[model samples]
Target: MIRIRKAETADAESLALIGEQTFRETFGAFNTKKDMDEYCTKNFGTRIQQNEIADKNKCTLFCESDNRIAGYVQINLNAAFGAVADTSQAEIQRFYIVKNLHGKGAAQALMNAALDTVRRLNIKHVWLGVWEKNLRAIAFYKKFGFEQIGEHVFLLGSDPQRDIILHKTF
Candidate 1:
């Protein structure tokens, strides 16, 4: 069974590990080792996670299986990054599940938690960016009722890549 819960500051280290592990597992083969190493080191550091946990505008949730973190999702409550029409918008910053748990309903549980959090916050809209080349991830978002709205450039280390922006209105 997957248990979804709000992440506390104590989870920073675990988040860092899972964040890097999942990220590398997903994108490592597509990119160079230098790029992956740089991105992971800069973004998944424990200190950064600690600061993120302290941010009031961000909500991070973890999905646990057998008492270990199986996945996680992070949302930016003050999202205005892309073509948002109003203040009733939030961004699904990062939604990642371990490779081993990809098809085991962990993602669904984590997504449900994110949507519940958004609805409880009275945010009527949600959006996220997915790499254009990542068809699996795009399909997953589409299955969750998100639609393509726009495109933007995302920097993965030294690489400038295009990310298709998807939006959903609750």
Candidate 2:
């Protein structure tokens, strides 16, 4: 069974580990080790995770299966994106699940939780960035009615990759 719950500050390290692992599992092959390491160093760290957990505008949720964390989602209430106006919107800054749990309930649970969170907070729109090459993720978001509104460059090490900015308006 997959259980979803708000992440606690104590889960910083575990969250960081999962972030790094899932990111590597999903995109490691296409990326150079140096690039991956640089990206991970800047984005997936215990201190950074902890700060996010403590941020008032951020909501972090964990998906647990068999007493172990299977995935997580981080929602930003104060979403800042050039594609959309900064009003009445939230952003799914990060959403990741272990490769083994892809077809399982982890991703669904986490995505549902994220949407529910924003809805509860009275947000009218939600957005997220997905790599252009991540076809699976793009399709998944499309299933949730997210439409591509813009694009941005995401720096992965020295490579500047394009990310599609998808949005869903309630």
Candidate 3:
């Protein structure tokens, strides 16, 4: 059985593990080992995950199957990419699923929970930044009615990559 729930601080360690694993799996192929290691160590550590989980302006949701985390999504109500004109917007800061769960409904379930969180907050718009080269993620966002609004630079370690800013207005 699959279940979705709000992530708690206690789950930080597990979240960190999953976050690092999925991030490496998704981008390691296109990036250098040094860059991947730097980014993962700096951003996906347990302390970082705990801080994010404890942040009041952020909402983290986890999708679990058979008591193991399959994926997670993080939304930030207080931050937005400069491209978003609307101040009343929530940003989907991170959305990742295990590679094995790609064809399953874990991503969809996680996304649904994220949108529900946005609706509950009365946010007028929801936006996200996706790497320009990540075709699969771009397509998935488009399926959710997210349209490209602009572009921004995303720094992964020292590498500056372009990301398409996408938005979906309620």
Candidate 4:
């Protein structure tokens, strides 16, 4: 059975570990080792995870299967990319699942819980920035009704990459 729950500050270490692992698994091949290492070190520390988990404006959800984390989603209610003009919008900041569990139902379950939270908060729209080269992730977001609205620059170390901004209006 799979269970989804809000992530707490106490889960900081686990979140950091999974965050780094899943990020590398997803994007490592497309990036240089130096860039990947720099990005991971800057973004996926336990202290960063703890601070994010404790932010009242953000919601972090974890999926557990057999008592171990299988996936996670992070949503930010306080901000959105400039494309989404509505102040009533939320951003799907980060979403990831274990690579081995990709074909399983974990991603769907995590998305369902995230959308449920959006509905509960009465958010008018939801948006996210996906790497332009990440076709798999873009397709997954499209399946969830997110449409490309614009583009933005995403920095991975010193690399400036394009990210497709997508939004779904409720």
Query: Which candidate tops TM-score?
Result: 1
| Per-residue lDDT of candidate 1, residues 56-158 (tens digit) | 9999999999999988999999887558777799999999999999888999889999999999999999999999999999999999999999999989989
Candidate 1: give its CA RMSD in angstroms. 0.8
Better of 1 and 3 by TM-score: 1
How much lDDT does each candidate structure score? 0.93, 0.92, 0.92, 0.92
lDDT of 2 by residue, 1-170 (tens): 89999999999999999999999999999999999999999999999999999999999999999999998999999886666775898889999999999977678778888898999888989999999999999998998899999999999999999999999988
Q: In lDDT terms, which candidate is top?
A: 1
Model 2 lDDT at residue 85: 70
- For model 2, the stretches where C-alpha displacement exceeds 4 angstroms are none
TM-score of every model? Answer: 0.98, 0.96, 0.97, 0.97
In terms of lDDT, model 2 sits at 0.92
Error (Å) of candidate 3 at residue 120 is: 0.8
Residue 77, candidate 2: C-alpha displacement in angstroms: 0.8
Clashes of each: 0, 0, 0, 0
Which residues of candidate 3, in runs, are more than 4 Å off? none
TM-score of 2: 0.96
Candidate 4 per-residue C-alpha lDDT over 1-170 given as tens digits, one digit per residue, 9 for 90 to 100 = 78999999999999999999999999999999999999999989999999999999999999988899988999998886776668898999999999988868889899989999998999999999999988988999899899999999999988999999999988
| Runs with alpha carbons beyond 4 Å of true place in candidate 4 | none
Error of 2 at 139 (Å): 0.6
